[model samples]
Target: MGTGTDTPHGARAHARAQHGTRTATMPVVPATDWPDPPCAAGHLVWAETVAGGGYTHRPVARGTEIRLTDLQGDACAHLLLHSQARPWERLNVADTVKVQWNAYLRTGRLLLSDQGRVLATLVADTTDGRHDTLCGTSTLVRNTRRYGDGAAHSATPAGRELLTLAALKNGLDARDLPPSLSFFQGVEVRSGDHGDGDGDGTLHFTGSAGPGGSVTLRAEQDLTVLIANVPHPLDPRPAYTSTPLEVLAWRAAPTRPGDPLWDATPEGHRAFLNTAELLAAKDPS
Candidate 1:
């Protein structure tokens, strides 16, 4: 991967970070659309194209493997995860950041819950690690100020609105909304002055997911997933524009201690243990 630079457009304050990859647990499905998926293995569960600015939601099994493809360059998928059995126990971005001790999520990073359970893992990111969790998603207020009020609900409503509706479909409401994990966007932090004036510290959306560039995840728990196919909060596009995203899911093989995600870290191991206990109690099996 190449380092990013600060320019008139949004970008990370620094250059690119070294990229990483991992094996997929499912077979690739070429017929389901988003041809030439990044993952070599994974059968298609179902595929959906979230129109730019539109939002969608779905329920996925614990062992399902997921792939998100940016059919066009520069797309954002603001995602949130929740336990299918317990809606309140959803993704905790703070826990994910603290447990990993890194703000940037890469392949092998665990997405944890507030109860310290593993939700999912970033098994692959084909955009050379250009995804971002820092810039977040755009909202009505934000879009109105940055673009205009009319731009708020055209196709890409604020992430909050989309997520709220997505969650409501799964028996959750606004208060249930959690901070999301952003993908297909990358940001760089910068300080000091640029040519015009004081630069201070700033994060620029310098990352872009080129065509066929993809990210894949393996769900460690049954997940109620919300997706916002909206522009990244920091996108510098001339207009409030976003591109469609193709989401693919497949059945996954049972994970063992030797699995990539299971052994990613000592904390991951313990987190899975907790998740297993919770699932077992729910199943009585």
Candidate 2:
């Protein structure tokens, strides 16, 4: 349709532009401070530094180990996980707490889904084993009230808002979000004479994890992981304070029947069985 002189030149230029933009890209920003011997053999799949009040999301294959490190003690990493194949199956915080028969988090603990399958397992914890599930991520309203500015680009962004954006990038919306788990921060429950039966207990924000604290979770299934590095909602500090967070993930094998974590508890053992059943169905070979 165009002039004969212009047609050939225009087609060549446009084809070059399209090819450059369509190429696949991967991010690799290694952290020199943290020495991971296991990662060297497994080969690092992802390495990133999420700044304070920032967020990130990605889909990983089964058997990937993700370690979140609070580069500085003040960072709080709010995390969420969902089954990539079946987005409806998501992290159920209540089931994770009830089925495990414990409200506290530590090594060998399983993160369960509402469907009774294990989504991930805490393989390593460098902190005192204190993490918070009762207090979810910060919100725009709360962050605005506390820090006077809660916009995502502002100095103090709400974790919920940040996660909402991250979800959008992954073809999800705000409604898809569930309760999140926070690392590098802790909460303590105190009950009165009522004996915690009436659900009357004080939830106290103990504090943040010390410098360079970290936790590693092994994915039991293909997963979509979302993380927001922000301050805890219950942090009493008037001024907004947060630090950088390090995210590292590498190839690894999921827990098996003989593994210590798999045989640690009856409830967890059953959950792992459920996960294995589902995974096997997806890939018979």
The prediction achieving the highest TM-score against the true structure is 2
| Model 2 poorest ten-residue lDDT run | 20-29
Residue 56, candidate 2: C-alpha displacement in angstroms: 1.1
* Cα lDDT of model 2 by residue, 126-185, tens digit: 998768988889998988888898888899999999999988988888998999999998
User: Which consecutive 10 residues in model 1 have the weakest lDDT in total?
Assistant: 18-27
| lDDT digits (tens) for residues 1-285 of candidate 1 | 333454622244332331232123222234244354434444566566777777777899887888888888756889999988888898998888887777777888888999999888888888877776665666678877776652435544688778888888989998988789788877765657667463666776676857777888888888888998788887777576788787888777546567767877887888888887887888876
What's the lDDT for residue 169 in model 1? 92
Structural similarity to truth (TM-score) of each candidate: 0.79, 0.85
